[model samples]
Target: MPRSKRVTIADIARLAGVSPGAVSFALNGRPGVSEETRQRILAIADQHEWRPSSTARALVGSRAGVVGFAVNRPARTLGTEAFFTDLIAGVQSSLAQHRIGLQLVVVPDIGEEVDTYRRWRRSNQVDGVLMLDPRVDDPRPALLRSLALPGIVLGGSPSGPDDSATIWLDDAQAAHTVFDYLVGLGHRHIVYLSGPAEFEHVRLRSEVLAGLAERGVTGETIITDYSPTEVATTMRTLLSRQDRPTAIVFDNDVMAIAGLRVSQEMGVAVPTQLSLASFDDSVVTGLMHPSITCLTRDTFGFGEKAAEYLLDVIASEERLPDRTGPRPHLTVRESTAPPPA
Candidate 1:
């Protein structure tokens, strides 16, 4: 004969000739069921090899056993960017220790990201969330609070006192390091090839560049979507000018490589004529022909810390204070040198 179907409380109740409530009480070791009924229910449950369902556990205010990470970036960009991959790996490493899972999603804009959070909460799909790339007036923090969701805002400063804990890096100090290094190298005319202007880090870096004007440095800003095609087009325009900048700093390594390729095509010798640097570092930065100079940080460690914080908040049901995260340090390579005399 074939094995019997797996038994639920209802099935066990029918087989034992008792009500479902009585079976539930017996199975759970609650008081209402007699010793005789409890023994029979246990035998039937064991015979059917019944196990608790995770979904059922969630509906009863128990953990869903997973956390969420939703990023508001173009899907194509995430495919090319190494920053997120490293960060996510760190998060997974920490989560693995606690036998937790991560659910990552990519959305086109903030609106969709907010909707995702709502859906996750309604279905009890995630225990908490991890937010990234905070904007100047970001609403996600408040939204997370409104939904009673525990979250950590990574790579950004706290927007409000009552908002979720923020894991912030000092963008201003990092930008100053790059700017002062270029100035020390005798590059008076510099250009900042930036990412979207709405990003708080981009705004902070631009502010740092603007302050250089007092020191008699000519700093210009050009914003892009961090796409190679747009970066190359902008690079071509910059290199075509007679008064081209002596050095250009990019927001990411991919953009730096795009600009470097454009410079080579335009017959501009790197370091000898124009110096190139980037804010984010990856293996490609070091493997490039001249090796782009960049800011290096432990992105993986950052992800791990974010995961740790969110999990702690979820477990304790308490709000944690904002924290300062690691800042990127300058890594000089062959791409940067004294401006052409």
Candidate 2:
């Protein structure tokens, strides 16, 4: 079959028997065109694979066609964590569909992250931003709002400004799931190895563990940098104690894997002597010895949804409601079992 000419809005209007203005209104999702006419115009546009050129979009005030994501984490830690890698792939995948690019930056700390956002806004380097690792009393939301820049927060509520929308998982419920599973396995002494304490999700998970005190199940939390070295040291330190926990939960798959290695070096057997579980499920967790039990969610899909929301916010002046992404489900594998007799 002969290929169709590069479809244009005028071609869509001519096919749908509507004015070009009507086609524009319908395609942009603005009011003015009747719903019936809007549907017809959309159908014609879809049939022809019509997409506006970046030049056309720029005439309508579109910026550099780029989005920003800044992370305040050490390069070593970021390099090892599969979650960031998978999440970035997903975000890029979604943005690429619309010809939008991502401007990712790694900063040394929160202060640097704030400065990066400021620079991006002032220089018009990015049309919008995607925020992660939300903290209690976070400054990013307010900073973005003050700059009048569009942004979407991932993994928690917007504490600083309502100008930004949020795409979050039910972290509290996920924490409960992990705790409940461990308790059911007859583990009383448990420990949670958490990422940075400032992260809202980490705090939420910590709260869930603390709440289990009423059930005669005690819990302790050790904050780490989510690096292999920190995780290994933390695991070794905890395991060397006389009252070492019979079960341990880690924040991410990398730390869980590191902890597993520490267990081997210290001559501690998994599942038999110590039950291990991690928060984020990844391929490494599944392939590792004793297959780590974990709370599994589509981190890649999470990134995609977050990027989609940010794009919508950037395109429209309307306020979108905060959305909850898919909940994390617990997947049991060989890493967790009942406490040793």
Top candidate (TM-score): 1
Error of 2 at 44 (Å): 52
Candidate 2 residue 112 C-alpha distance from true site, Å:
0.8
- Candidate 1, residues 115-214: lDDT per residue as tens digits? 7786576446788999988788888888887777788888645546776787888888989999999999999999999999988889989989989999
Clashing pairs in 2: none
Candidate 2, TM-score vs. the true structure?
0.80
Cα RMSD (angstroms) for every candidate in the order listed: 11.9, 14.8
Q: Estimate TM-scores for all models.
A: 0.82, 0.80
Stretches off by above 4 angstroms in model 1 are 1-61
Q: Tens-digit lDDT track for model 2 on 1-341?
A: 12466777787788888888988787766799999997787667655546565567567566878999998888776667888998899999999999999999899999889867765664456899998888877888888877778988897543333546788887888899999999999999999999989899999999999999999988999898877899898988999999899999999998899999999999999999999999998888999998999999888988888889899989888878888776779999999999998
Runs off by more than 4 Å, candidate 2:
1-61, 157-163
The collision pairs in model 1 are none
